[model samples]
Target chain A: MRREGSPFKGLSVVAFKEAADHMASPRMHLVMLLVILTAIGSIYGAIGQIKETVGQDPFLFLRLFTTARDPLPSFMAFLGFLLPLIGIALGFDAVNGEYSRRTMSRILSQPIYRDALLAGKFLGALMVIAICLVTLWLMISGMGILLLGLPPSGEEVLRSFAFLLTSLVYSGVWLAASMLFSTLFRAPATSALAALTLWLVLTLFWGMLAPLAAGAFVPIDPFDPSTAVHQAEIAHALARLSPSTLFGEVTLALLNPATRALGIIFYSQLQGAVMGAPLPFGQSAILIWPQLASLIAGMLVVYTIAYLSFQRQEIRA
Target chain B: MSTPVIEARGLSKRYGPAIAVDALDLTVMKGEVFGLLGPNGAGKTTTILLLLGLTEPTEGSVKVLGRDPLREPLVVKSRVGYLPDAVGFYDHMSAWENLAYTARLAGLEQQDATRRIAAALERVRLPHVAQKRVSTFSRGMRQRLGIADLLVKGCELAILDEPTSGLDPQSTQELLELIGTLAREGMTIVLSSHLLSMVQSVCSRVALFHQGKVGLVGKVSELAGKVLGGSYVIELEAEGCDVPAVARTVEGVSQASRLSNGAVRVDARSDVRGALAAAIVAAGGELKRLSMDRSSLDEVYVRYFEQVDHAA
Candidate 1:
């Protein structure tokens, strides 16, 4: 059966208005400043290291994202750490703030349904994140050319673009998470703290805890190397539960084409594979397709939870 | 009479264990200003929410403009405008921007929205501050802008929840006048407030909500007559004799009492001014001053609430 008007009737107007608000908000400015400063610092340090050690390398541009100074991590690593914070900042007040301000009822009283409002907010935050990531990518690439006096190859540019898209999706996962918390909590501060706490645990401690859990689940015989491999495989699977791990693996595969696999491999599996030979762009993309799909799926799943909750919520607020 | 613009049949709402509204039956006619008057937690706001389809009814149904609001909310909401109690707006946005946003949400074209927004602001007497952010606006200004928002939407029925709650006397009068103008322009209005005098001046009919159920519903004058047993009170000042004893003998006089000022106050079923004055003169008292008093809405409101309290 067909419905009369689209559920998303007012989506574009709401999205545009919300996107403008997000861009002009002080919270967004502060987070964007921090991300840019760290990104530039990491890229500058990577340039210095590349000049000293890999001056003649054909894929020198790729090192800008993967290389790290003694004290600082790579540009991609900084992004993997900081992007979720930005996402959380943008979304932690999405629903609750409207209620606290007493605007939710007035907005809902309009001709649109709750679907438009939720979709508009998510899309608006996503658009802002996409814009920030794309701009930062361009700035880093531009600085690479200016400082190194060498332009990136077409393949390097394509890979970096793919990395940027992956970063956008990675941030979307956190955005959806914070939006969910916003719906669950009545206070904006509570929602922000909740999202930030979950992010801290998943990004900083999940890797360490995954191994312990995996070892408990699949105990390895100390004398059997094959059992140790099985334990390692299980630990790897557990670690991938955190979106950060999935994002890190995708970044690694995209930015460093010579890397073949994310998990343990047998000697027979590597016999015919070319060592140190970068895979083609299509192969690299296919290699990380599952990881990309998982990130997108994670975002959709969290957003769907938020959407259903918002629809069920009373309109008194 | 014309068809009722708003109709609720056994409408009820319960939040968890507490019943906010219980089996409300109400009908508001076209172009008439209906008032919902009650104290806090009396379910006036809950009934308005149900009528607007903002909250779902637990056990009954509501229809706005002949369509079930729950079944087709968008269609109903498109034609109905609601100004919630303590109305809120995007503080950072200008009044024009706020109204324009609503206009767009209501599906007006850009040119049409712009034109209507200007007119709406003018109608609310807020055109001078159209470009200023709502954060800088005073409370009265915000209330006027709320009206401007409804006007921009071209609502067929305007439901204002406590539109005059926090305003000063002047602002309250101004808002009531604006509401009167809207009703005169043929828009049906449902105004919910605890201010009985305000409702008396503007609403043609009202429903008194007590403990989540409507205790009384009728025209204000009709209610005064029905509940108080009389609509008019006659007072006579005399100098020589017992005026209260004589006024009590007049036809249609329900009760008579003498005040300290030597005025006999008589509650009568109808106009008994001539009879009251002649009766006082015949009793050997010189009638000095005589006046007629109609029962105010305040008395009717208090009486209904008192009755409900006693029943509970």
Candidate 2:
């Protein structure tokens, strides 16, 4: 059944058209609208406050803008949570919407392979997210320059870009998650619900639930702060298995480079140091690497499941 | 002779414990319209699915254009256009957008894709409202868009499943005309329908499926020749007479059904009019009416199916 050369000449033509149709869809319009509103709102909100904060102390603006110093919980919260949600929203309907449109079967009937469909969709959604996120990031920085009246240090600029890369990768994880759900469920509503349920598990419940479970099994006292934090860290690792929160955690770490990496509960910075202290970044990364690996592995696992399921599913359905 | 565009040798499909199609052999030659006629649960759709490689065969092999659809589906599929029983379209897209999408997938260059999109819409007579979203299109229009999608592929073999299922008489007529034109253009077509009249009118040959098997297959005329033998049946107003002797005089007459009221019916091999007329005149009986009747497709379909049960 082998063709001597490439066979998708006509199929690519068709897939390309479907991909274009995807771009002009109403869902793209809605995502863009939300992105525009978020950028405008965030920029103006910073503008409204930048003056007073700058006047209060000459160093205040420098610390906030030029360095990661005094990074507020609210900024981290917005960057960590809202951006990933946007990624999810962009992709939640990807496969399921195609299924609903009845274009999926038609496309499959062509010579285009199944993976190309997924790849095209992922690329399209990523481009859309890139546009929105990049716009927002630039808008915020522009507002900072105008109001704070301070230039970002080279270090700050480098870190911001690093943070942006981290944010993009983090968003991709959610997009994959959303698409995985899309393939798992046939109905768009069900796919949306499944994605949100994952979000809630990662964002709200996983953090609290893991610690409680570990604590229950260990049955340690709160006065033992180290023990409790250990449990929380373990719980966080377990929770990070949910790609959404793992991405959020990774992005937060990138935004503020001072924070310790996530993974194992380090007894102290010492690997049998003369005296045990908090773990160093090397030890922390070593500990966190496993969790990171696990999170990446989990994404692949779900994606693989979706791929196999789709390959196996009959066109009759 | 045209090459066989679709060839299947003992094709079969089983959905777990249920056998959807069983040991079915078929071949559809190029540039001819063939039909698979059956009722709703009689496996017309299953046979089509097997041909498209949408479902794997449980027992036998299928080759379209000399390629196994299961193994080289992309190559075969690229050359084959399929319109499922219910052609589904994205409701949000206009007919033009939908056609454009399919055309691109069919591997037409941007320029050619646009050209074919227009031509297909025109062929279906849907060019005027090309930009109208399928959501607002009536059932007939949606079906038209569906046909346009299949045609845009520019494939050699076209498969239409339940093409006229819900169509009104006018739309059905138009669709039939379009099909006639495609056939004239030498496009190999596989038409599945439950409408015997439609099949009888357009199909050169047919494969009748029943309970997951091809119960019968032959040229429509040949099948008609074998199943519908020479016979004449007429209701008559007649007084008492020698009905058997009148029947015997007709050459090759096999049997006759005589009503108690003296109306005579006869089954014969050749034209029985002269012998019957001579017998009638000699016997002093009046021939009220005479007409000929042959075995119909409906009866052949019934007889073949009943034979399946008897053999089982």
Candidate 3:
């Protein structure tokens, strides 16, 4: 039977309630604090490095994110590494926590479909992540101007804004993945562990597993010289299967304006091209458009799976 | 006759190969406190889910207030308030905040929601703890807050699943009284519980669930009369002269037997204490005690199930 009424009738109500809960949580506070402290440390380190090579680079403002001193990773690198953790932490118990707390049935009993509840939760956490990323971006930019004694070019500002948007999407991918696990597992602790396990596998071990899987799929032939290139290409394709790899490529293209290509370039393809010359913001955006699309697609795909499972799940705790 | 607030015909739900609710039929009328009495996994909760359209039945149909719950769930859900079995709240939030969240979900406006929330808390007697976090609330307080949540939504029908399962006796009594007040104020209620005595005290009518089927459904008194063969039992303690024979002579007496304590147990169609006392006195039997036994729900449930078990 076709269901009457809009599935999104209570969407905003659920989203606002969930977002307020996220903002008030101690867990969110701790994550935001960690991000802020790291932002400050990384900006401080980048300023020292930029001062040492002052006047040597045209894109001095962009260097604030890419440059790093010893003992502290660059801001861009830290975000690439920590964004997934932040997303996972915020969403690991999104659905199952309601079950464990015995609130799922009551909430479901309201005049709303499961679509509203699951979508609201994902969007609510995604909104918080966006807010946090925007705040961090503003802080870093503000610190860079204060310490570097220069204003960023309009193009630089736009590129960094794109970078912030990419980071938000990247975090969303992990958030959706964690929520999928939360929907699958009943215990909050089990879901947390499952999400963390996936994170560890994708972040720490995916780089190594990519080549092994590729090599198995396309064995390197000793007789053919070009097979090595083919093998490397397959490896690269396999590695990009991980969301972290897609996010890392997007980060590289946005933060490093001179990035012209994400994959291996043949000598003929680089003919007459000036190396190390910065590409326009639009060109850089075009370069990572596919990567950005993949990030968004990955997020939506994971979220849709979570949505389907949650809809079919029994509401009794 | 009162119009039915809920109606189900041949409703059945199956999870894979296992039947959770088997071909069931039930009806609850407006402003009546109806109880679903059963043990765990006897399909009471499953029936509530089906009525609310949280789960689709494998077969059959159900309607709430003349609307098909499966097709028009929002309308049905808006009218029907549910307090789930072992109901839970967002513990970190204050009780008022929790109710306000549900009120918003119910589409109540700001001013209206605030007023309703205050009145609901007052009704449930939790106005003093309105701002206190629910994490500190006792189980009974939380259950009461659950009721307040239903009240704030202004639902016409309130379905409570095991509302008094874990409450202490005092809290149970208080909650039952609150449920009574809701019924008096013209709310149709469907309460599901495994506890017999609690349901007996408040419910106007009940359905006894056994193995995914309702073995019996009717007014408690009527069921007792049908199942136990008599609605009232009298115990007479007397000295001398054929007490059972004397008790049997009274009007409305259905059966009379002698117990080991030198007392006559008389099953009667109604309260026969005065008539039996006079009869015993005239029979020249010295009476020590004459008391009418209250037919409890426990006996009806047990006796009905025992017959089913024996037949099976």
Candidate 4:
């Protein structure tokens, strides 16, 4: 049977309310502070390095993200490490927090369906994250122009924009993962812990686990040299299962235009290529198209799981 | 006759192997304070959820404000206001902000929301604390804010779950008066509580819920007559007379017996004090005192449940 009325009738209302709450919250403020301080520290080191090697690079502005000096990682590396933290912090208590505060039933009793609530919360947090990312991007570019004494090339600006977009989608994967846990677990702390544990395992240990899993699937054979290639291929495929791996591959391809391929490339594949020549922006994006698709698909899958569970859950906590 | 504001037929809810609400039927008319009186876990809150379309029922149907709640939830919900048991608000937001959030969700214009929110807070006598964060408010104040949330939406029907559960007697009294005022203003109200005295004071009619089913439904006086066999009780303190014998001589007296406290307790169909006094005087007895007891919901609830338990 068909239900009456649009399930999205009050969607913007819920979204605007949630986004306002997040923007005003001390948690978002503290997280944004950590991000800004890290950006300043990393970009400071990058500018010093870029100044020393100014004449050698075509994409000097892009180097602001990739170049790093001692005691600090690259700006892109910091984002890869911290974007998941931002996403998790925003979503680990989305639904259960309402239950803890004893507001779930009251909110659900409004004229909207549960579909509006779950989707609105996700959209609202994503909007906040997007705003934070755009602000940081503008700051980094503004700092690059002021410090480097030159504007970025059109190609360099295009590649950097792609990098920013990839980072946002990467964060979406983690946000959806935590929202799924929030729907599954009643306690906010438990959901946060679970999301963090998954993040730690994927970010830190998945690199190690991939090879072991691949070795079991396609064991190395001493008699056949081709077996080694097969093992490496299997390992690469296994690593791609982790969203962190997908995000890293996408970031590498987008920010570094010279990157032609993601996985196990043979010497024969680069035999006729011009060494150190940066690919066009479209080519680099095309190279990471599958990785980008995987990141987006992973986010949608996790978010869909959360939505279904939340729809079926009892509103009474 | 008043039109029904809420109607449910054969409504049931199940959580796995356990039944939260069985096949039950109920109807609440417009402009009446209807009480769902029962112990905790008796399906009162579940029924409210079903009526509001917050949860789907496993069987049967419900209509609120002439619309099917399951099929047309927006219509039902927009016209209905619900205050959950131990209702909560965002602790960090001011009372007006909290109500404004719900007003927006209900699709009110900005200016309309502002005006209605002020009027609602004033109606609940909470205007002074409208700008204060909810965390600083007492439980009674929080409950009043829940009511104000309803008023801001201009809902035609209000369903309250245990609104007076955790309050002191003074707060309960104030809340009941507010509910009475709302009813007087032509708002249909359905409130559930295990507190018999509170429900008895505010509800024009009550349904006694037992194990996910309503065993009896009527006015409190009617339930008392049905369960306790009489609606009035008379206590007589007399000297130089047989009190039970004199009371038995009066018409409409159902039962008469002498108490250990030396008072004759008489159960009657109605207030038979005048006839009983005349009979006592004719019997040459000097009456010291005569009084009639009002029928109480507490007695009806206890006696009804006792009978049910014995049968079970």
Candidate 5:
């Protein structure tokens, strides 16, 4: 026996097979249907709003992503809420499902390292997510062209494409979280619930708790206006701890060019800035670079934990 | 002699305080079918996992086909195929797809993988159901498919853990015959099973495992001969006479006893059937039946385990 080849000898095979399985799974279909219907509905609401609102807006196409109807949130908001469900659906059963189905041993027995198995699963799920994101982007842009009859500017295209990339990393964080839970729990349902519970806490409850925690950490004087500013800053920092908050801030910075900064801008900071002036693509990207890096870092951290755990796991079943 | 296909020395595995395989040494020769016989929880499965490098041993080393399994696992795995106890396949995938996935993992190109998958399915006698989902397969078919998976990988050594388990007698016979064919074609196989009769029929050499250790290891016949030490027995059925008393006085008869079935059993250091028959006839007793009793492998197996138990 010789050991000269790459450690990723079987990665493509496993990735292709897993991707096909994810594509065919009913859970994937259900999540995808939920995302697609909500996305279309959101985009439709944006288009109707554009039709009713100011007719001469230059970045009309971009507004299709950020604008919302009176009752419905924007498409970006829906994605920030729903994309994790898709990510969790794809990954919650990745490792344990193999164990439950009794295929983990057989798969590992092949001439592949554990690195390849974990890498293949993550890559396969990410591939599915990429496809879904690209399809939705194209559909929304296509529908915008059909209804609003306005071609997007180059800046609009660049900004919206950046938004899509940021969304990928955002969902990737949840996917890695789900895979981490999958590695921790042997039961697929348990892992799924665990991932979902984390998602719910971060998306819904974390916002409410961050302010209270920040108030406790940085107590403010009731009569001091500057201390109030300090409290708001603390709350903002605490909220940034959640991946959803990071994603939301990134979406705002990318989709709305008129947005200047993510945090509370002081009067001195806004002195040189023009009101209603859209930032350049480069500036907007620079503004959100930290958020992007944090999303990627969160994903890698969780995925690395899952990968190491999987490597150390006993392959009995 | 050719080099051993597998070698393990002082190999041990401990899960917390429970020892699964303890300081075991095993060597398997090339092109021979080796059997690991043990009852449940006797470390047969753990030993297989250790040999495959699926789990790290606590205390020793293993070399499969001249490569250290721990250091060169992919190399060893590429040459070895393992069919775990109660083997499983992707239930939603067709048999061909399942085999093709393995072939791809083994690094075969598409054209080569397709050709080999077809050949393997045909070899396992399951080419007709190549496109059917595995969930719809019978147990025998799934077991045969497991073999096909090994075949497609072109593994030099096939490790089958309880291969005939859960199969009907007819299926077991067929699987045994298939194993025989593979062995004759010069494939080294390591088979583990608790079924002594099945192991005796197929294994050229065997290691009887007890309490996480090999209690006995040798050729079946050699172990029987060594343990029994040339002692032989003769059974006789006689009527109208004191058969047990007369048989006890025969030359070379060490012990004689009347069995519950009205047959007299005589243990002898030499062949005593002819002498016993002659004495019975001379005593005016009717000789109903006379036959030499051969020591079965089952007896050797039972005695070996009993002796080990007593020593423990």
Candidate 6:
């Protein structure tokens, strides 16, 4: 018999083939249509917002381009809450579908390394999502240019680029999460449901409970207004354990130039943003440094667990 | 020296408490059809998976093409083709598309991939169904597609696990012929099957697997000679049910019984047909059906397994 060599040198082709299949699949088409409609609608509405405002602060008018704290929470927080869920949806079934097909064993039988397989798949999925994100960012920027008579200033573009990177990294957390779930679970439906449930927990349930739990651990009562502020700060820090909080905090930093303190929320009023002395993006990154590290760390931890589990699993199926 | 294509030393696999494959030593030489005949859950698939490096064994060593499968899976896998017991595939892709994708994954160039896929499909007699969706294909068609995939793999050793299983008789015959063709081309194939007749027809060397071990192993001709012990079946005409009486008059008679079709069936320890034929006429029985049906692989396999089971 001939001495066999590595047969899976064409992993890139496999990745490309899978990505093409994803594009052809009905679900991806629906996802594309939904994202397109939302982007177009957001662009039209932003144009509408620019046309109607009068006598507003120049900073406040500029603020539409960069987020600032107001009666509503920061702009970045909302995007943070939504974008990762989209990432999760894109990846949740990536591994489990192969398991269901009884093809995972056949794939593992090939000469390619396990990490190569995951890397190819991750890069493929990332490319697909990046296509969507770039289109949305371009639309937002174009609308700002045409309607608001503002091509984003140099500083604004820098922050927006940083924001895009942060968003991608933040989405990496979800991709890592969903891939881990796919490996852990045998069924595609279960992997999907589990990812959705985790998204709900981070975005909705954790938002409500983690702060409240932290508040309960505090020594002070809220009836004392001045003291309550101190207690709520502790609650907010504990609440940031979930990715939603880090996303909320980081988006706030990227979107609102006036919103300073690196992302440390000191005020008791969760809805109210701290009106602090303006700080540079460098300083702001320093403040939000811990949260970003946590997000990156979270992704690594989950991926490591999934990789180990995948390596250990029998190829019986 | 020509190294054996596959060599295993005390190879065993245990799934938690259940022993899937016990300590076993095995080998398959280059350019031969080696068959492992056993029932389901008899470690046939486990053994195949081991060879592919899809699973790590609990004990012992498995070398495919002189490389440890677990340590150098890709090295071995690139030269080994496999057809699983149930030929499952992606439902969405057409047969040609699926074959092309696999070929691409197997590192074939675009032109070579195309050429190999078409040749494989044609070889499996699936040229017409090449463009059809795999989900729409019948079981036989899917089986053909699987063989096609293996063919396109261009491996020296083909490990086919129950390749013709669940196929109709005609398909089974066709599959056996396909194996024969591949074997003639000098591909070393290790085939596992529950179908005794199929294994017997296709495999030059057969191993009787029982309870995670090989109960018996030898060439079919050698085992047949050993089992029959110079015995040959003789068919002759007899009056109704008096076939036994004519057989009793024959010298060197070992066993005799009347067949369902009214022909006296006799198994002798030696060439007693000449004596048996004379005895039939002397006993007023006319010889009508006289044919020598060699003892089949089915009987040899059953006898081997049963004897092993009894000893255990």
User: What fnat does each of the candidate structures reach?
Assistant: 0.56, 0.52, 0.82, 0.85, 0.70, 0.46
Candidate 3: stretches off by over 4 Å: B236-264, B268-272, B279-289
Per-model CA lDDT versus the true structure: 0.90, 0.69, 0.90, 0.91, 0.90, 0.75
TM-score for each predicted model, relative to the true structure: 0.93, 0.81, 0.96, 0.94, 0.93, 0.87
> What does DockQ come to for candidate 2?
0.41
Q: What's candidate 3's DockQ score?
A: 0.82
The residue-by-residue lDDT of candidate 1 on A197-254, one tens digit each, is: 9999999999999999988999999888889999999999999999999999999999
**Residue B135 in model 4: shift from native, Å?**
1.2
**TM-score: the better of candidates 2 and 4:** 4
lDDT of 3 by residue, B1-312 (tens): 389988999999999999999999999999999999988999999999999998899999998999998899989899899999888999999999999899888889999999999999999999999999999999999999999999988999999999999899999999999999899999999999999989999999999998889989999988988898876877879986798887777889888999888777888888888888888889898999887544678878888889989999
Q: What is the per-residue lDDT of model 5 for residues B72-178, given as tens digits with 9 covering 90 to 100?
A: 88889999999988888899999999998888888998999999999988888999999999999988889999999998899999999999999999989989999
Model 3 residue A19 lDDT score: 87
Instruction: State which candidate, 2 or 3, has the greater TM-score.
Output: 3
Chain A accuracy as TM-score for every candidate? 0.97, 0.73, 0.97, 0.98, 0.97, 0.82
Clash pairs (backbone) in predicted model 1 = none
Residue A130's C-alpha lDDT in candidate 6? 73
- B1-312, model 6: which lDDT tens digit per residue? 156998988989998899988987888899879999888888888988888888878899988998887776676777888777766788899999988877877778899988999899999898998888888987788878887888888988888878887889888888889889999998899999988888888888887777788767789878867765666667777563377876876788788887788777788777787787777677776677666654678667667767776888
Model 2 lDDT tens row, B87-170 = 778787788877776666655788988888889899999999998878888778877877788788888888888888899988
- DockQ values of all predictions: 0.54, 0.41, 0.82, 0.77, 0.55, 0.44
Q: List the residue pairs that clash in candidate 5.
A: none
- Writing each residue's lDDT as its tens digit, candidate 2 over A1-317 gives 44332433443343354446556777666765665565455545544555445444322322332232122233445555565576677677777777676666666677666666666666666666676667766766776777666666555565566556556666777777888888888887888888878777777777678777776766657688777666666666666656556655554444444445455536666355544233333444454455456555765666677667766777762
Error of 3 at B94 (Å): 0.6
Ranking by DockQ: 3, 4, 5, 1, 6, 2
Model 4 per-residue lDDT tens digits across residues B170-206: 9999999999999999999999999999999999999
User: Best by DockQ, which number?
Assistant: 3
lDDT of 3: 0.90
Which stretches of candidate 5 lie above 4 Å from their native place?
A: A1-5, A223-226, B226-295
Q: Which one wins on lDDT? A: 4
lDDT of 4 by residue, A20-47 (tens): 8899999999999999999999999999
